[model samples]
Target: MTRALLLVDIQLDYFPGGAFPLAEPEAAAVAARTVLDSFRESGELVVHIFHVATAPDATFFVPETPGIGFHPAVAPLDGETTLEKHQPNSFIDTGLETVLREAGVTELVIVGMMSSMCIDSTTRAAHELGFVCTVVSDACAAPDLTLGETTVPGASVHAAFMAALDGSFATVTPSASLV
Candidate 1:
């Protein structure tokens, strides 16, 4: 089966000094770069997914802003496939499925930011679409989350989401093991 590498929302907005920086996003990007390089070396399919918020009330990832640009560490190289999306699920109106199907990609190696959001959503969607997904856990970041009176640290949020996704949705792994 053909496999592809999917880098989701590793954009400027998630890094330090950006709109909504996540916890240790740089580390995640570095690890993702490792996997990206591996895919490039193998001449495998690599798709870079960017989230561009077009809503009038959107706060981050606004259109035509540097915040929406892909981070340098995992930026798509020349000739690599790049797709933009308006929602957390990368497949929604993004032509990602069509692209994958055309490329005969049956498996996905996913790495990105916000483990609790886009990463979770995309992995679930990919799994349901019958693609074998392998998430690079260390190559995905998560922001601090708070609801009601409780606030969860990003590390805890990341670990919890990774735990939830393992086996059920995707095979959660690390960059080192992958490459």
Candidate 2:
């Protein structure tokens, strides 16, 4: 099957010194970079999804801000496909499916930040849309989540989402095997 590397929101806003920095984002980016390098070497399709918030008083990923720019580790080259999305699901109104279909991409190698959100959302959407998906676990991160009086650490949150996505939505594996 044809494959494409789908990097979702690997931006500065999720890293150190930016808004809503995640736990171990540098590690995640480095892992994603390894996978990206492999894809580049193989001359495979690569898609970078950037989140640009349009709502007023948005906290992160706002338009015209450096925080919205891609992190250096996973930044796109001249020939790579770049897409700006407002929602967690990269395919939602981003023409990601159309692009993939046109390129004859049937399988996706997914990576990037906020595992509990974009990574989970996009992977589920991709599976439902009939694309075979493989999510790189170590190449994704998550912010700590809270529910009323309880708080969950980012590592736990990430593991929980990956567990939920594995086997059914997509095969969840680490970047080392992928690279």
What is the TM-score of each predicted model, taking all chains together?
0.98, 0.99
lDDT of 1 at 85: 96
The residue-level lDDT of candidate 1 at 113 comes to 80
- TM-score, cand. 1 vs. native: 0.98
The C-alpha local distance difference test score for the whole of candidate 2 amounts to 0.96
List the global CA lDDT of all models.
Answer: 0.96, 0.96
Model 2 worst lDDT window (10 residues): 170-179
Model 2 lDDT tens row, 98-126? 99999999999999988999999999999
Model 2, 172: alpha-carbon shift in Å? 0.4
Candidate 2 positional error at 148, Å? 0.9
Stretch of 10 with least lDDT, candidate 1: 69-78
Per-residue lDDT of candidate 1, residues 54-95 (tens digit): 899988999999999999998788899999999999999999
